[model samples]
Target: MAVRKLEHVGIMVKDLDQSIPFYTEVVGLKHQYTMTHTNGIIRLAFLAGADAQESQLELVEGYEGELAVEGRTHHTAFTVDDVEAEFARIKQLGVPLRDTEITTLPNGARYFFFYGPDGEFLEMFQPAPGR
Candidate 1:
């Protein structure tokens, strides 16, 4: 069968403890469960939004540092309702942003990037209509 939807997005973090709160509070994702890799010193935490149909956010820890030298990109962006409001809320938390302004899409979506507590890049945005 063909793919129906994206299942989840995986993020690599330096520490789960530091990254978890931002996902739960700022991004507002709910923790589902965690798993410890049998063959490595890695941990995985899967989180979901209120709408279960959407994909989950998986946080991977312990596979970072100097060993992870390649392949991991900067960050990933997820859909949001009001990017401006979300920016205001997160800015109030005093998290130093990697960039201080919002990026605009050709279709009018507003967005920006910031680092999570674990220093992982995270992008949030509000999409334009028909986008």
Candidate 2:
């Protein structure tokens, strides 16, 4: 019940080498870091403005699907104090979920995907301490 703030918005990209620079240089955002998903498929890169504490942009690469030119957003994540709690609560409410279990990233952050009213991807994310 305590969704704190917007965590990040994920955008599907064909190449991180190209998207990373575009967001950092052209968009005037700072590249925070990059990491590969635990699934060993998707590559993720985060970017932020002057305030790293705020919401960020995530560039996702290695998706084996067609990327739409207009709507490239992959998912929208919201910061949660407890991802597990939220996941349970959402399930109890009968919300459609994309992930059966929470996914732990290399950085220790945990997240799970759920479907919104329109079938758009939404995430409940609990960031690792100090992140």
* Per-structure clash totals for the candidates: 0, 0
> How do all models score by TM-score?
0.47, 0.96
Q: Clashing pairs in model 1? A: none
The Cα local distance difference test for each model comes to 0.69, 0.92
Q: Largest lDDT belongs to which candidate?
A: 2
Worst 10 residues of 1 by lDDT: 1-10
Clashing pairs in 2: none
lDDT per residue (tens digit) for residues 1-131 in model 1:
12234545667787899888888999998987776754358786878898755777878787653535473443566667777776777798897687688876444656777779888767675645764
Task: Give the alpha carbon lDDT tens digit for every residue of 1-131 in model 2.
Answer: 99889999999998999988889889999999999999899999999987788899999999776646887898999999999999999999999999999999999999999999998889999998787
Relative to the unseen true structure, what is the C-alpha lDDT of residue 120 in candidate 1, on a scale of 0 to 100? Answer: 72
Model 2 stretches astray by more than 4 angstroms? none
RMSD of 2: 1.0
Candidate 1 lDDT at 17 equals 90
